[model samples]
Target: MKYVIKTQECGYLFKNGILKKILFAGKYRILSMSGWELKITEMTGKVDTKGLPTELLMEQPDFVSRVVRVQIPDDCIGFHLVNGVYKQVIMEGEALYWNVFEKNEIRLVNVTGTEMTEAQVPAMYRHLIPSRLYKRLSVGEGETGLLYIDGRFEKQLSSGTYFYWIYAHEVSMKLYSLKVQQLEISGQEILTSDKVGVRLNILCSYRITRPLELVQKTDNVANLLYTRIQLLAREYIGGFRLDELLAQKEEIGRFLMKQIQGVQEEYCVEILNTGIKDIILPGEIRDIMNTVLVAEKKAQANVIMRREEVASTRSLLNTAKLMEENKVLYRLKELEYLERICDRVGSISLNGAGSVLEQLAALALPKG
Candidate 1:
């Protein structure tokens, strides 16, 4: 039999079901045996050995000169480049490509005890890499991230995406909010100086100023701040009487800011503002206050009624004195009384009287 291999093709010569040699771009006369064969393949791309031993294939210096061999280590990755351009990513394994026509290169990178940097592998090939081979972290806006490798602090990351290979190291992260956040300490019970129990709800706004210092000082910054505020509130409340605490509810908030000045610095936080939301009194105290208010209002009403009566009496006495000083005024008062009496009586018949006007005047006068 006669076999012809093209200039851009390779021929694998097999004799009795075994590969004998690799033929490249040549013409040869092969015997027509039952188990003899010549497999022709294109040399434009990867060379497929089809389970043939690479050592046996490399024995031919002519075959070795025409192709390139890549042995990717188990802990390393290979980036295949053709004609000075990225073509494919080669995982852990062995690969072979023809170098006769175009230039070929396999960039080997060790993925042990190191992160995946953009310089090591270009950003354009991020999607080409396998997802399981690397770890990804996204730090959103108004937040900062702390990166740790093998339980040791490494560095801080701003708001962006980061990639690291999980080869032989453990990767962990901690996020801290930079914006102001509210903390509510609701229904906290305390005793006043007068032994009065009160429940208070407090709110405070804060933000993390130094995330690294906070992490080093305390395991949880929020918890530390909460405890400080709670203790200060209790101490301030315990010093004031019940009446004073109720009168100066806003004073408690101001006291908190002054007392927590040192603590805020230690915790690496900025205290924006603090306030007392609600002050809950006991049922017994509330009832007593309601009763006292009702009694006070009743007393005020009585005093106002007595004042009005005294004013009315004084006005009457002044009018009587004016009438006594002048007979004309006395006559006018009598006529005024008669006019009022006539309005009430529809009809009247006088038998013992000098004239109707004189008799009416006499009747208007007081009997005493």
Candidate 2:
């Protein structure tokens, strides 16, 4: 016979064939069951056993007059209720969700009704996923749908290719709110880690297509651009002294800009402005350069000093020659000697002085 069981907990009606003892009698054991068939009497009311078979009265529901409670601590664990049966199913962690959905067999609730190629899936869903998941999806465009790798996007990705996406709710599949393009390299990709400890230099110019204000404060786009340029510059002009770049500033700048442009088609970083940011020179090499510059300056100073000395000597020689060629100069020299001798002599002794004066005059005359 059917029995009407009422309780303050959930009210649920069970058929005789489906009812089974989930817990031992006499103990308030919380039972976990599955595959129990049931119908919703009132969508807004609690669960109760009002029209269930007598055998179904063995257990009490959690709530009888309240709404169904489906609270999950973590969204990573999915939950659903069908036919009064509660089910818990684990989903891809935040990181793997994008890649999980890219697989043909996996399905996402909001991702249906849109056409995508293998290459476009990661790019399309990257922003929709959490940052951790966003980074894990290696998305690339492909024929069937967007191709996604667990971590690396794909093989043979060229430089200058961009991936575009938006939050799922921001726009219909028709438009993308976040558009990221990839820059492809014509040649093979070179790994920087492979060349660690190698001396290098870089120079580059970049321009922002969008307003600078739009970029995040922590993005460090300028610094990153500079670093990449420096890497490329080092690849071409490695081992060059810092002073050498200073000397050949124009040439180095041009070479760096050219190399940056070559990689521009691959990296997708804008080249709004370009320049050499820094030139790293080995400490020993820089000291040597400083020494050479100092030596050069000293040599220049010596040359200047020698020229001034030579000019002074020439002027003195010319003055002496002009004085010897003129009779007025001879008189002046005799007068200068007489003034000095007269000052030293107390009385005039013309008798012997005349002879001394003649000898002095002969001695003072310029040689032929």
Candidate 3:
């Protein structure tokens, strides 16, 4: 029997149900007892051997096409997972041939190992690997990262890049700052020794002295530290009256620093500074203080004025006593008063015209 072969079709010659040779792009005549299998494939390709069985096609590598061939370069590796299970790992710079005809799959995995272990291979297929195979942890600057595996602390890393593989145990990281940090505890209202309610704003600057103790010993170190600071500030403020606190705020700062010293060791934090940022009195109290300040200033002004007036009066009395003790000085004073009177009168008229000059001189200082 004769079969008509198209130019785009490849013919497989079989005798007694066994493949013998391949036919390409031509008409072919077959014997009546033999059979012919024709398949259409893209000629432009390396002749897609995807539909062909790899076990049988690999035997004739020369005639096979690059349908499912995976090439692993020198810097990479290839993994082949068969039937959803890891079967083989190809090392650097290797080529693997495969086809889709079999019920198997092959994927390429890039890793760094001369040979991969069976235990290290993921049980899943290649497509779902990257998300399940490994994990990454970034320890930023000024932060210390703590690595934990299966909820157990492993090691602490400082400001760097880290990578880990996840197969059986769960992996995670906790970061704590190693730099100086500031916390502002604001809007706290406490009672003073004078039973006056005053609002306080506090600022604290500190750093992590012991990272391991801060992270492992306490679950919420920041909250605990804040609580202690707040309590200490209140206790210290309660010991002083409003007037005393207002007089010397530096004293409150000193007391606050003293109180926070013990908190540093307890929470593993170095208390660099602690101070009261602002002291806000109640409206009524602020008004009362203002009134008191104004009244005290007025009393001081009145005292200064009375002192100046008394000093002036005593000086005048002493000057009068000196003038009475000396007659010539008294006569000089009479002439001084006459000069003052003449300065006020711009034009003075003398009654005695002929004796005006002599009379004026005599009236100015008589017989002195």
Candidate 4:
């Protein structure tokens, strides 16, 4: 029988012959001999057995046996052996894989799947484990969720899935957004309560930019915003004693707008609008204000009357001092008075020059 031997590495082929001989009686033996030597023994014909050579029948060594090192990209699909056997399967998308074998010790083998685009790669990787509690949250525009991995809270994550280590108690969270819409204050759309009327509508929205772990820390931001708005409204609007905001409508509107803007800045939220719907005032307060205004006016009038009286008294005193300083001026004043009295009375009666002298003497004397 003729056989062939093939080496897997060098592909070297060798042919040999197997001879069966009867030694002694009833004993048969098989011996493998070189084909060239057997041919010189005068074999009648070549006998062939369809089988793999003895050297080629040995088992192939494992691909990882001589692997010295390996480098895998982040987004590899799967890896396989050079002998056409699959090794590792990557479940997630956008990953890389590689296998490095020792030089000359084993044949180096590489297996790879299809590649993906850079734009499709996730900014961060999030691992999810089964049987673990996770907080599901919805985020709007300008809002974020707080996630605690182990015990530490992370800042931000691009939009994607995330996982946290399981603990005896699951983490808690409050979901909220950072975008704030200003309330609309218009007469047509005023919000009316039992004591006050407000015209404002708040609209908020947010978008997620990272893989976020939802926990109790996430609740702080939203709570802060709500608390701030409520407190501001109470402090600014409720503190006003004026039942009717319309009386000082313009002033109140401006003040409220400023307060809303301040709150927005504090929370890092965008202020959409701040509006004043209506001014509310109690009837009793309005009447009281009117009465107080009337009383003020009366007091002002009294002050003016007293001032006029003082001015008249001062003028009379000045005139008297000037008359005393000049005797001729006093005589002139007396003559003028007589002349005015004579014009009104049809005639002036006096006992000649004696009567005139007596009148002049009387006028000159100081009256007790």
Candidate 5:
């Protein structure tokens, strides 16, 4: 007898119900014998006992083969379990050859039919997982998230769970603080128009008017507001001299609002109230101003003293005129003088006087 086999397949020959040598692709010759049997098996693409008859792969481990080739379904994934424990995740396109023996069994399950997320999958299997398959965003009450796709602003999202299917587009979200916020523009050196350098500190309190614009219009709203404050303050200060700006610190802040009043509107930021916290002048300037103030006060004191002295002299002149015109007026003036003298003397010894009261009254008069 003669047999021929194709190059793509291997042939195994058995005679008289006993195993024989394996045959590769070619022609084989056998001599005719009594009670002779020839069994041929074809090994395509890969040779395995799985394609062979069931009797060939029975419980006999010595002669039986449990090695099999399995290719995970294109639409399914393989969760490799060993000893009933999760081993590793097998990608959809991955094909593996598993030899099941004793207690192990290899199987494939449909991934599309199951409710699972990429996050649930182990990190070691991330590279094989799809990006946009799971939702990554969720917003709660009193909060908002800004959605951006492919680095472009899409829209605003309110409180709720948000999902994105990451296919070809990149997804990202930015959360904003909606509660009232206080920003401090701490000590910033600003120069006045007259070339006097001063440090100005300001405080600004605000809340978000439009959450979408607040996030999309600027990279950092707080930073932008800070920059705006500095620029506006410098511009306002540059237009005024030192003395005026120092005197009207609050008023200068008003001008800051007037020049760029609605500037924050561009970014959807609302300005509640902006006020100057403090103004600091240079040491030399402060000392010089203090000296000038003290000198002006001293000058005022001197003027007041001279005015009082002149009024006292004029009153004395008027009193003298009255005395010269009337004897009664002169006597009254003398009596007034005597009373003052009596108040100063605790006890008195008068040489000629009608009474102690008379002595005391006459003490202030001239001897003549």
Candidate 6:
């Protein structure tokens, strides 16, 4: 029998259904009575020995020279790199690849540590790793991530990406927004000093100063601050009459801020600002306040009108006195009046007039 193996492939020579020898690219002649057969395999794939001993195949120097053998330890994984490029992940075991065509190599990685940073496995290669082997966490911008290992807090991580080996232990992450945040405590019903019921809507802006201390102080920071503010608002508002509250609304905010100073220090948070957003009055109280405001405005208008009338009367009296004391001033004033009448009337009838001007002056003068 005769056989030919291509340059890119090798042939597994079998004799009587048993492996005998490995043949590289070439031509060979054998006895037809030997009942020999050949199986062709690609050189780019793993070496298949057909149940033949690997050592037996290695005994052939021709086979050993053209293949690369890999042995992975139990505590380590392997990355297969062909021609300096990543091809696939190699598990913990023995494997063989044909090295006749392309350069074959393996890079080993230790799995003893729980975390695999970018230094260990660059971000470019992270996608190639199996999803089951690692757990990923991404902390977005304006957020702080807390890493926990086995139900215990480990360390704070700023905004970035992280990966942990899941086979090592249980890993978890909690993220909190670090930017200024607002909390609305709305629709709170409380009684004022005068026993007037009102609904208050309060708003507060806060930021986390020391996240570690905050977590130690309370499991839930938002709920704690909300309850504290609510109680303080009720306590402070209860001491002021409804009228006083409406008058000094800003004062209430300052009082609440002062009261929560201790809480802020203990909880490790900075209260930037707080204020009463809205003070919703009862229907009856609202109607009464509207009526009072209208009455006050009307009284102010009436006072202004009376003052103007008094000033006008006094001026008239003073002008009359000046005219009575000086006849020349009185005649000038009469002429001014006559000029105004002439502008309104086109013509005037004169009766027994010494002169037109004298008659016109008499007609323009007021009767005593």
Window of ten residues with lowest summed lDDT in model 4: 40-49
Sort by TM-score, top down from the best: 6, 1, 3, 5, 2, 4
| Residue 315 alpha-carbon offset, candidate 2, angstroms | 0.9
**Local accuracy of candidate 1 as per-residue lDDT tens digits, 154-193:** 9999999888887777888998989999998889999999
lDDT of 6 by residue, 103-177 (tens): 888788776677897767778887877787789999999889888988899899999888888766789987878
Please give each candidate's TM-score. Answer: 0.71, 0.33, 0.60, 0.30, 0.47, 0.82
lDDT of each: 0.85, 0.41, 0.69, 0.41, 0.66, 0.85
Instruction: Output the number of the TM-score-best candidate.
Output: 6
lDDT of 2 by residue, 1-368 (tens): 22222222222433443544322112132223534433323222222344663233434332211223222333232223234233223234321111111211223323322223344343434334444222232323321122223332233222223332222212111111123333222222222323312233333435333322323232445455556664665565444544454667667667766666665434434554354444444577578878999999999999999999999999999878977998788678777878897797676545554555686566567989
In model 5, the runs with Cα more than 4 Å from the true position are 1-180, 319-333, 344-346, 349-368
2 versus 4: better TM-score goes to: 2
Q: How would you encode candidate 4's per-residue C-alpha lDDT over 1-368 as one tens digit per residue?
A: 43322221111123453322101112222233444222211111111212433223222232123122233433322232234433333333322111222121111111121111223222132221123322333445555655544456544433344433232334443444433333332223233334543443322222222224223224344465445555555566554434444466567556655665665544545544444544443467567768998999999999999999999999999989999999888878878877776687776456555545467567557999
Which segments of candidate 6 are over 4 A away from where they belong?
50-55, 307-368
After best superposition, candidate 5 residue 221: deviation in angstroms? 1.9
Could you tell me the lDDT of residue 132 within candidate 6? 74
Error of 6 at 1 (Å): 4.1
Query: How many pairs of residues collide in each model?
Result: 0, 51, 0, 42, 1, 0
